[model samples]
Target: MALVNTKEMFKKAYEGGYAIGAFNVNNMEIIQGITEAAGELKAPVILQVSKGARAYANPTYLVKLVEAAVAQNPDIPITLHLDHGPSYEMCKACIDDGFTSVMFDGSSKPFEENVAEAAKVVEYAHKYNVTVEAELGTLGGVEDEVSVEADKAMYTDPEQVQDFVNQTGVDSLAIAIGTSHGAYKFKPGQDPKLRLDILEEVSKRLPGFPIVLHGASSVPQEFVNIINQYGGNMPNAIGIPESELRKAAKMAVCKINVDSDIRLAMTASIRKYFAEHPDHFDPRQYLAPARQAVKDMVAHKITEVMGCDGKA
Candidate 1:
C-alpha cells in the first residue's frame, strides 16, 4: 500500500530467481504506464529518478507523481528510488525527501573513497529506514548526466565486491558486466555480450546478496524500426540483448534498471502517431498512445525478461 524499499523485493527476487524491473520515470504518463503494468502483472516495481530527471521535472513534481501512482495502484508494492545519486548530499536530500531508496554511485572514484562515501550515505539513509544501493564498476555510454567512454568502462572487480559490500552495508550492489548506459550499447557489426563470468565470481563471493544491473534495457527493434520509419535517424542503435538480461536475472541479479527502452517506446509511438496525424495539435493526442506504448513495453519486461510477473 505504502512506498516500500527494495529490501523485501530483492529478498523475494533472490529466493524466487527472478529480477525486479526498475523503471526510470520522468512524468505522470510514464509513471502511470509503468505502475499500471505492475498492477496488472502483480509485480513489485521500482520507479527511479535520475539527476537529469530531477532537473527536468522538478524533484517535488516527480515525488508527487509517484505518490499519485501509489494511490492509483494501492495493491502493488512500489519503490521510489534515486538513481545514480552522485554525492552524499544528493543521497541525503533524496532520503529527506521521502525516497524509499537511494543509490550512491561512487564507482568512478578510488575504491577506498567509494566505500567511505557510500558508508556515509548508508549510515544517514538507514536512520530514516531508507535502503541504499551502491555501484562498483564504471559502465560505458551515457544516461542522464552519467557518462563513461567505452575505452574507460570497466567490469567490477570481483575481488573487491566483498570488501565494498562489507564496508558500505548497501542493500544492493550494481555491477558492470558489459551492459552500458545508453541505447548505443554495441556497434553495428559488433557482437553484444555480457561478462557473465565476472558475475559468477561476484556471486560466489557474496552469496545471497542482492545484485543489480544498470542499463539492462533491450532496445526493442520494433520500436527502433517504428522510429526510423517515421522521422528519426538513430542509426544502428542497439542495446543489451533480452536473452542475456534474462540469464542474468536468474543469476544473482535481483534488480534490472531499464530506461532507454522506455524512452524509445514512447518516442517511437509519438513519432508514428504524429506521422499519421500531422494535423493534430494537442499533446494528449500523441501522449495517449505513447503512454500505452510504455505500458506494453513494461508488460513485456515483467512477463518475459525480468520474469517478475505475479511476484508482488
Candidate 2:
C-alpha cells in the first residue's frame, strides 16, 4: 500500500520472530535500492532519513522519492521514518511533512529531559497516527550529526525501561546494547557481542514492546576488500556478526538499523566500476551497478540477518 507506521509492522514482527529492516536513504539510488530489495523479497521496510540526509537531499525530495517508490511497489509495505531526530520541532516537522514514523533521539540529553521531550513529541505524533521511537541510552560512534564517545556509551538500563515507556508513550524503544554507530563498530581483535541479557531484562519489563537496535550493520568483508582493492584505505571495518543479529531478531527486537553496510556496498561497486570502465563518464552507467550492490546487501540482511523476508 502506501507508507505506514511501524506499530502493526513491529507487532507482527515481534510475534513472528523477525525484525523489520530500517535502511537509511541519502539519495535517489539508495532509496531505489532499498525499496527494490524489499519489494522483491516481499518484506516490510522502513526508509529512514537522518538530519544530515535531509540537509544533503532536501526533505521534499526525499519524501517524494519515497512516495515514488511506494507507487512503484504497491504490494510491499514501506514506512518513511525520521532517524535520530534531535528535537521535538524536528520530529514535528517530519510528521507534518508526511513521515510515517519519527524517532526522538534524546539519548545524549539528561534522562529527565529526554523523557520530557520524547513525551512531547509522542503526544503530537500520536494525534496524526504516526509512530514514535525513543532512545533510552546513548549509542557510541558517529553517524552524520549523531555522535557519542565510546566511553560515554551505556547499555539501556532495563530497570528504567518500563518507567520510560510509561512516561513517553513511545511505540518503540531503541537501546544501546553494545552496538555502536558507524561501520567501525569494533576493532580488529575485539569481539562484537550484543548484550542479550539486557535485552532479556527489557523484554521482561515490557513484554512484547517493540525493541530497536541502532548501528546494527554487519559490514560485509567482501565490500571492504573490494573497496581496499579498488584504491580505498578503510582498515579494519568490522560490524556485528550476522549470527548475533539473527539471534536478536528471534528475541524482542523488532527493528534493526543498517546504514554503513549499504554505503560500503555502493562505494565498493562504484570504485570497481570506475577502475574497470575508465572510459565511462556518465553517472548512471556506474551508479546503476552501485545501486544493485546496495540492493543485494539489503536483500541479504532481510533474508539472513533480520529474518524479515516474505513477512510483508
Candidate 3:
C-alpha cells in the first residue's frame, strides 16, 4: 500500500478504542526500527519528523528514509507526519515534500493568530489530500525547538476546543492534558497526573473528533536504569505512567507522540554495548544493538501500552 494520511488511521483508532503510536524519527535506523516493529505487529503507525530532525538529517534524506521504510513494510500502513511544525511555511513545506500529515503548532501564538495560521495551513493541505493537526494548549518541557516552562504550560480549555476545531478545520486536535515534553516531565515530589476530565470534556464538545496527545512517552524505567547503570547521570527523570496513557488511548485520544522512550532505549543499549565491547570501534558494532533496542521498545509500546497491535 502507498503511504497513507492519518485520517483513516485515526478514524479506525478512535472507533476501536486504541491509539496509533507516533514515534519521532531522525535517521535510517530509527525509521527501520519503528516501522519494522509496527509491520510485524500489523499495527498502523505515524513516523513523525521534528524541525530539529529536519535540520539534522535534511528533509530530503528524512523523507527518503521514510519511503524506504514504506517499501520494506508494504503490508502495514505508515504516515509521515511533521511534529510541532512551528510555522505555516514549515507545515506547507512538509505537505509539499510528501508528508501525509503536518501539525501546525501555533500553541505559543495568540488564540486568533493560531486559528488563522492553522486555518491557512489546513486549506492548503487539504488541496493535496494531506491531513492537518493543530494544538490548542502548550506543553511544558523541551522537544526539538519546542520548549515551554512548567509555569507557562496550560491545559486545553474544553470550552474553546469546539471553536478551535470549527475555525481551523483541522483533521485532528492535540490538547494539553498535563503531559509535558522530555523525560523529566514532573518534579520528583509532584504528582504526575493527566487531567482526564479535560479530555472527557473535549470529547463531549467535539464528538467523534480525532484527538492527539503530545509528549506522551512513558519513559520505561528499565531503559533509564540501563543508561544510569552504564555510566550516565540522568537523575530523577520521570514520565507519564503507562496506565494513564492507556486510559487516554481508550478515551478520545487517537494518536500518542512518543520520542523520549526511543532515545533512552537507543542510548542505554549503545552505552551498555560500549561498556562491554570496549575494543569494538565500528559504528555498526554499537548501532546494531541500539537499533534492536528501538525495535523492542516500539513493540512493547504497540502491544502493551497503545493497545493497537493487530489493528492494521
lDDT of candidates 1 onward, in order:
0.93, 0.94, 0.93
lDDT of 1 by residue, 14-77 (tens): 9999999999999989999999999999999999999999999999999999999999899889
Prediction 3 TM-score vs. true: 0.98
The residue ranges of model 2 lying beyond 4 angstroms of the native Cα positions read none
Residue-pair clashes per candidate:
0, 0, 0
Q: What's the lDDT for candidate 2?
A: 0.94
Please give me the total number of clashing residue pairs in predicted model 1. 0
Regions of candidate 1 where Cα sits further than 4 Å from its true position: none
